[model samples]
Target chain A: MAEIMSLSEAVTANVNDGDTVALEGFTHLIPFAAGHEIIRQGRKDLTLVRMTPDVVYDQLIGAGCARKLVFSWGGNPGVGSLHRFRDAVEHDWPSALEIEEHSHAGMAARYVAGASGLPFGVLRGYVGTDLPKHTDTIAAITCPFTGEQLTAVPALRPDVTVIHAQQADRHGNVGLWGIRGVQKEAVMSAQRSIVTVEEIVDELNPRVTVMLPSWVVTAVAEVPSGAHPSYAHGYYERDNAFYQAWEDISRERDSFDAWIDRHIRNTRDFSEHLALVREEGVVMA
Target chain B: MTATLDPPSTKATTDEIMTVVAARELKDGVVCFVGIGLPSTAANLARHMHAPNAVLIYESGTIGAKPTRPPLSIGDGELADTADCVVSVPEIFSYWLQAGRVDVGFLGAAQLDRYGNINTTVVGDYDHPKVRLPGAGGAPEIAASAKQTFLLLRQTPRAFVEQLDFRTSVGNAEGGSSRSSLGMTGAGPAVVITDIGVLRPDPQTGEFVLTALHPGRTVDEAVAATGWPLRVSDDLTVTGPPTAEEISALRALTGA
Candidate 1:
């Protein structure tokens, strides 16, 4: 059963150096607080896995916490390039970083295979693309029944998976709705899991579309507005302006370092970080 | 640039024409797997104007999303709020997309070859790229699995290349039946709508040939913009200018 713990405690207890960690969210309900906690804790050599490595991954990559990234897409969503990610890949500013890339279908299949306790997942993908040339994890497999060719990707079994959700009942059952991306599969695919929720409630809302029965999770933390800059569907709207501002803030190495130092490292927690960003007029009130 | 000989009163920009022309390709009630940017705008415009029953699927797992405004990102709350239902990422790719439920996969590209293969991964060497692009997200599979694909990108010598730095998605390999030989479920890119004109794969060669030029655009301009030795259809025609309704609806949807 999941033990209710503080975000710091959860990070300390679960995440370790050189671990293959996955913080999964498509674009909504990203575990920004948890990512920040990992950064604050100064974990190193993590093999970060996410489908879309959004700005949070950018931050982790920039902070030199990640030695490698396993993802499908790495961008700032509607905004342009993730400058920090670009920097790390192109110049290796703080340190050299390695990347193992795949298409969204391949990554998703790998997660599903991991969750299903399968050795690999098969799909009709990467036929004429050069992705297979670059990624060793992708290979051709023939169907036993049809003798037809298909692509097989190995299961993505992570050491830990972290996600942010709307609520977790006192029993530690996590419930979330609205654009539920791969969080369930990610949790199931990991040896350990952390869920940071907006609030801990007496009972989970019945309307919640996806639920984790607490047994699958290792720990839960209540960190309201945990998906800030991202969104929580019902609780708040996406701070698109912050995403846009990130383009400028993350463009330069010094500016990004200063921002991270002031906001994430120095702040007591996610709430404090959110408050400081808002107070400094970095985000809307 | 040559001035339009018969300028319409509505005065639609080339981008508007490109979007309008692309939107017209979507048949009523078709399921479209949409990429962000121009493809999303065109798909949404089609939903609002002609194909009201059209299904717009984003990679974020929002199926049948009917957003009032064009979403800034695939996972914007508006998409989820207005979706028929939301599934997990794995299910979206497997059960919906790879299952062949999607009829049209609309996409955008950073670079493309004459065979319609895309390059959104990198602009230079894979190890040391001059410009690293957002790598293949869902395009490779969408191009391989969606019954047909529609590509949208501005035409430029740099983009319409003879050789891609990296082929992120397959259209028609080597301009022949090679794509089919690979056992792909879907016919690769059917149409490539650009700022200058519309290009369709030749029935015989599978090479994308200039089939129609938008109003005021000339064959010379299209050829100049392409890096390869461009081919023009023998019976090439001019595309009609965007109607007043199309211009207005597109503007309203984009809020531009």
Candidate 2:
């Protein structure tokens, strides 16, 4: 069964140094609070995994918390490049970060295989692309039934997976809707999991599209607006302006460090960080 | 200079003309797997103007998304709220895309070659790149699985390179029947829509041939912009200018 804990407590109890951690949310319901908590806790040498490593992963990579990143895409969404990620890969500003890249199909297949308790996932991908030359995880496999050749990627089994959701019942059953991404698969593929929810409800709403029974998750934390900047379907809208502003704020090393220090490190929690952002006029009131 | 031969009534920008031309490629009800930037704009424009029933699928797992405005990101909540249904990322790639349900894969490229192979990975070496681009998200599989693929890119000497820094998605491979030998299911990159004109692959040789030039864009200008020795079709034709309805609908959808 899962225990209801504080975000800080959940990170302290679950995440450790040198762990393969996945904070999965495509572009919506990203676990920004959990990522912040992990950054604040100063965990190091983590192999961060996500299909799209959005701003949260950018922050983590910039803060020098990650040693490796396993992702398909790393960008600022509608915005241009993720400067911090670029810095890490190009210059290795704080540390030497290694990357193992794959296409979205390959990454998704790896997760599916992990969730299904299989050794690897097969797909018709990377036939003429240069991706297979760079990554060792992708290989050619011949189908047993047919003579067709396919690509096989090893299953991704992360040490810990974190996600943000809309609600969690007292018994720690998590429920989330809107763009469901790979949160369920990530949770199932990991040895331990953390879910930060907007609220702890008496009963999960019937309309919830994805319901995670308590047994699968390790801990649950109630952190309202946990997916700020990113959006929870019914709770709030995506702060696109912030994402645009991040382009400038994260462009330089000094600016990114100062922003992180003032907003994430010095603050007590996500709410405090959010308040600082609002007070500083970084985000609209 | 070909300035004397240019038309005066052409008021539409190159991007607008390109988008309108690309939108015209989508049939009324085809399922289009859309990339984020230019392709998304074109697909949404098609929905708003002609192809109302054209299903737009984003790799973010929003299937049949009918957004009022073009989404900034693929997984914007607007896409989900307006989608017929939403699935997980794995399912979207596996059951929907790799399963061959998508008819047209519309994509944008950072760099492209004559064979239609894309290079969105890097601009230099893989281990040590001069410029690093966002790596392949879904282009490889989408290019390999969708019934046909459409690439949208602004043509330039830099982008239309003779040799790519990295090949992220395969169109026709080396030329001719190379894509077939690789066992890829889809008929790779049917047409490449650019700001200057449309380039379609030759039926006999898989090399992309400059089939049509947009109004006011000279052939010399197109030739000058391409890095490779671009081949022009034997019977080259001029692209029809964007109609008032196309410009108005595109502007309304983009709010530009």
TM-score of chain B of each: 0.96, 0.95
Off by over 4 Å in 2: B1-10
If you assessed candidate 2 against the hidden native complex, which CAPRI class would it receive? high
lDDT of 1 by residue, B145-214 (tens): 9999999999999999999999999999887778888888998899999999999999878999999999
**Best prediction by lDDT:** 1
Question: Could you give the C-alpha RMSD of every candidate to the true structure, in order shown?
Answer: 2.9, 3.3
The TM-score of candidate 2 is 0.97
Residue B185 lDDT (model 2): 76
lDDT of 2 by residue, A1-285 (tens): 999999999999999999999999989999999999998999999999999998998999999999999999889999999988988888887888899999999999999899999999999999989999999999999999998999999999999999999999999999999999999999999999999999999999887999999999999999989998999988898999999999999999999999999889999999999998888887752
For model 2 the local lDDT of residue A274 reads 90
lDDT of 2 by residue, B1-256 (tens): 1122124533788889999999999999999999998899999999987899999999989999999989999999999989999999889988998888999999998899999999988888998888778899999999999999999999999999999999999999999888899998788899998999989999878999999999888788889989999999888888899887787788778887
Alpha-carbon shift of residue B181 in model 2 (angstroms) = 0.5
Cα error of candidate 1 at position A130, Å: 0.6
